[model samples]
Target: MSPLLTVEELLALRSSGSPRLLDVRWKLGGPPGPDEFRAGHIPGAVYVDLDAQLASPGSSEAGRHPLPTAAAFQQSARSWGLNSSDTVVVYDDNGLLAAARLWWLLRWAGFDGEVRLLDGGLQAWKEAGQPLATGDEPAPAEGDVTLGEGKLPTVEVDEVPEFVENGGLLLDARPAGRFSGEVASIDPRPGHIPGAVSAPATGNLGDNGRFAAPDVLRRKFGDLGVSDDRAVGVYCGSGVTAAHDLLALAVAGFDADRVPLYPGSYSQWASRPDTPVATGPTEPPLIDAAEARRRVAEGAVLLDTRSPGGREKTGPIEGAIIVDRDNLDAEFDFGSAERHAEVASLQTPIVVICGSVNGSGPVAQNLIGRGFVNVAHVEGGAPAWHELDR
Candidate 1:
């Protein structure tokens, strides 16, 4: 069965019977998913916390986002009114990237019923002129279902090295810069698992933020040496995006039975001193004020990640283009499409200017995820530049 359903198809299904809907909207940094859910969501869509329901409490040993126990997940599933044969549809605002995590989790927890992603996600519904509801949704009756672990294969931290050594492929679903040790944002350490290949999860997305066509995905994976015959494993900063990659793998026709997830991912690997790390590519040195000016003079783009108004208040760093950080991954006018085209077409060096290394790090990495090869971020952000100016 197809793992995706269009908004139109979902509306048709609603006429016959409403499938269980799960709103899995979440962001990495802030603005809790519940707050976003309270603002507005599809009617009857129950909100699920990615950090709470989808993952266990944080542990250095298990990584930042550990998999929830089967019994605990079953309890949460029952709370959402799931049944053994219920058809479930999951979605999020940030494309289907976050939603796919829930979809994969259900299947991994031994769900027998059908699970599908709302192709293009909630934005698709809104784009189709659908109405939205605001406020906390009432809880449905408890569900009669059971869940167990090991239904979907997962590699333990201890087993990962052996799995990779046994000729299995381990794919890293993080941006190339992070994978290459050029930048480290969220995680404590830089670099990737020793033998993993860099395959950014965003690479699986199309211009419209939906998964690329199956043939395109197949070709993309083929280019990376992924095949049905080889045992494949996937990981990301945490396990979240890796699940999206796992879904993409299944979409590309790799047998779900064969592809397993490294749920601990880099968070666990980097924390453990015993595990080895491999850095890739030589990154351009972070530019200071003088170097930044020199680069700008040499045709580089000083990419300001502050809001246009914020940039105005902070004062520009001589020559900088205002491309707000929040809108870097957004859609339409605020999206990276035009910005990416502008950068790629120019083929110039881009130095991201933010509040600090942490602030600019993610923005630069996101650009790298979008295929921008030459990128860097201001070392200490605007404050340091201001200090230099004074």
Candidate 2:
């Protein structure tokens, strides 16, 4: 069954036997969700407060937006009249960012029946000329659905360090700035987990505000060293947006059952003085186009991280050792055995280049982790090099 439903499909389902519609519209540091729900929302949709019902209060121990107890979530579900048989559909204006959280939590809470995201969200409904209801929605009948322990995987706060140590990949889904300790508006700390790779959640999205194509997402995760073989886990500012990454992982054909969420994320990690934190860039420091060019002149290896398709589309830079970012560190014949030996030796300076820092950054960091010294990625990347060249 599809994990998503179009507005037209939802309307057809609504006419037959209405699915339990949840208006999950919300924003970080914005006005209350209920206020927005009252102004206008999908007809028969119940307003679910992400802070109130979906999560517990903020605390130093649990971090902001801690998961609600199973009993508490079950009670909240009953209040919303969610039944074992009923299909639940959640939507938000912001491209299923918040909606996916609810979807994930429901499955985590042992919801066996269908729980889907409304594709493209409320805008998709409005764009389809569907009507919305204003003012408060009426109370629903209490449900009899029983709740159970979370079936989906979870990595507790204490387990994270060991997880990373044991060859597991701990992916920090926050932006590069937050990962680099630039500015932390919400959490107390400004850096990422000591060994986490910076795999920003926004990287999963397309320019159209929807998820990127499956192949694109697959390459994106692959670039970060997340494979079906590797043990992968994710975390963000709170547990909310982290689900977005988990969902993206599932959409990219990863088994959602294996991937776990570190609910505490940076918020809890930062609050605890005992936990170690790493600051500054996770990848090799970025160099500008001119600097990259100069380094190339100085006999540094120009490592192009763009995919074969990406390189073909943009045209290749001359004299580059093209190792697609997705296949970083994987054994491959790049030109010849001697060229491979040179990279494997890690003695020379390697200037990694991609279309943007987002793609190149992790690969550079991956190289550094493998004992590469004097490694740097192109700052603004290939376009920056092109500009300077022109």
Give a tens-digit lDDT track for model 2, residues 1-390. 657778888988899997999988788988788888888799999988888888888899999879999999999999998999889999988878788889999999998778888878888888889898999988999988887756899999999999999999888877666777766546776788998887777667664666666766685577567899999999998888888888888888888778999998889998998999897655566778887898788667888888777788777899888775665535333444434554544334678899889988888876655434446788887888878767
Instruction: Kindly list the per-residue Cα lDDT of model 1 for residues 1-390, writing each as its tens digit.
Output: 668889998999888997999999998886788999999999999998889898999888889999999999999999999999898999999867688788888888999999989988888889999999999989999999898877888998999989989998888887677888877657777988887877777777776777777876785576567887989999999899998888888888878666899999999889997988887642333657666665667666778777666667777766667775776654213344464444533124577888777778777766655555446677878877788767
Per-prediction backbone clash count: 0, 0
Report clash pairs, candidate 2.
none
Q: Which stretches of candidate 2 lie over 4 Å from their true place?
A: 284-390
Q: Model-by-model lDDT, in order? A: 0.80, 0.81
Candidate 2 Cα lDDT to native: 0.81
Worst 10 residues of 2 by lDDT: 331-340
